[model samples]
Target: MKEFLCTDKDFKDIAALVYNACGIVLGEHKREMVYSRLARRVREHRLKNFSEYLAYLNSNKDKEFDAFINAITTNLTSFFREPHHFEFLKHTIVPQLLNSNKVAKRVRVWSAGCSTGEEPYSLAITLADLFPSSWDVKILATDLDSNVLAKAQAGIYTAANVNGLEDKTLKKWFLKSKDGHTYKIKPKLNKNIFFKRLNLLQDWPMQGQFDLILCRNVVIYFDKETKDTLFKRYANALNNSGYLFLGHSESMGKEHSEFKNLGKTMYQKQHNARTV
Candidate 1:
């Protein structure tokens, strides 16, 4: 038996709160996971059961809610987790941007749902390698979880976190700790990235359009309706012919005519599609 009682009603209530708060759908299979994560919150508050915890959360939402969301968010990421995306960015996207953005020489990339900073950092490294120092290049990395955002902002990772990185790449972009237990991203590589906490379901305050948006593996937990809405939003956020990268498992449907599928879960914004 569990330490705290999590009845069906309690699980349902928690699920409802999570969905309403952040668009993540907690199905029946997620009940045990939810209980295991939230049970710690209950213990932290010295609550007797999940029921009391929920009531406390509702009453002190401003304080406890961030903790609640952070506990449940999954932040599994690594440097260059999807190599093909980076390869495509280097080969195809860079060449096009060079031709089209000759006057501006400005490139903007967004790593939505950038957990613990790997995706955006990878993007930064890639851009730093290709783009001239004179060009204005920037990356905006955003996530809903504050804890992970802090970790990402610090740019520190253990040896295990950077296991698969090549020796040359590691030496170029990271500073090894004296004890050799961890590595920190070098300032040159981290300079172009700006991290922020953002909920995708809420309003985005960014005024300029992005040249590429990587929202990989993020929409899998969302329902179809949410996914559709997010895809449209991504379309609007992107510049004409701007790219959007999804996870290997996620794909846009035919109804989303704003984006043209380029295979490998890559998409380019259609030049003549109506934006929402």
Candidate 2:
């Protein structure tokens, strides 16, 4: 038996709220997941059922809404979760930047939906390893989940959180805690990254264009229309010839002519492409 009563109406209401708030499509498959997650909130508020919880949520939007959003959103991430993206960054993209940006000596990267800091930290590690300290390099890591943002900013992880990394990487970039159960990222790697809370569906406050943007594994949750609009926004946010890295399972259609696919979910912005 379920802990809370989640009627079809309740599930539909939840789905509509989630989609309207963050552009995430909560399908029928997610009904049980949503129930399980929101049940805790229902219990926390001492509510009798999902119906009561929804009533409370509607009446108290300012306080309960953030909690509601945080509960429904899933955050699954790790350091260097996809290694090929980093390898490409290290070998191909960095070399190109060295040549193309030689005069400016500046590089900016955005890790969209940077869950719990791993992806941005991975990018930071790669850039720190290659770029001269004299060069201007910065990484903007943004996510809608404030909870994950707090953890990311802390830059501390369990020893198991870094299981697959090389010993050299561990030694060079992490400080082992006294109990040896936790590792904290070194300042050198963390310095280049700026973590911020961002909703992809909302207005972006970032001023300057990025040389590379990594929105990997994020767009899969959005509907096609939202995805198309996001791709256009990404195209506009990037510098000419800037690179975009999506999740291995995600790919843009030919309709998104602004980007030329380089395989492996990597794409480069076309210089002459029309803006959407």
Candidate 2, residue 5: Cα displacement in angstroms equals 0.6
Cα-based lDDT at residue 177, candidate 1:
96
- Model 1: ten consecutive residues of lowest lDDT: 125-134
Score each candidate by Cα lDDT.
0.93, 0.93
Worst 10-residue lDDT window for candidate 2 reads: 125-134
Q: For model 2, state the Cα shift of residue 177 in Å.
A: 0.7
Residues 222-268 of candidate 1: C-alpha lDDT, one tens digit per residue: 99999999999999999999999999899999889999999999999
- What number of backbone clashes does candidate 2 have, counting pairs of residues 3 or more apart or in separate chains? 0
Q: Which runs in model 2 stand beyond 4 Å of their true positions?
A: none
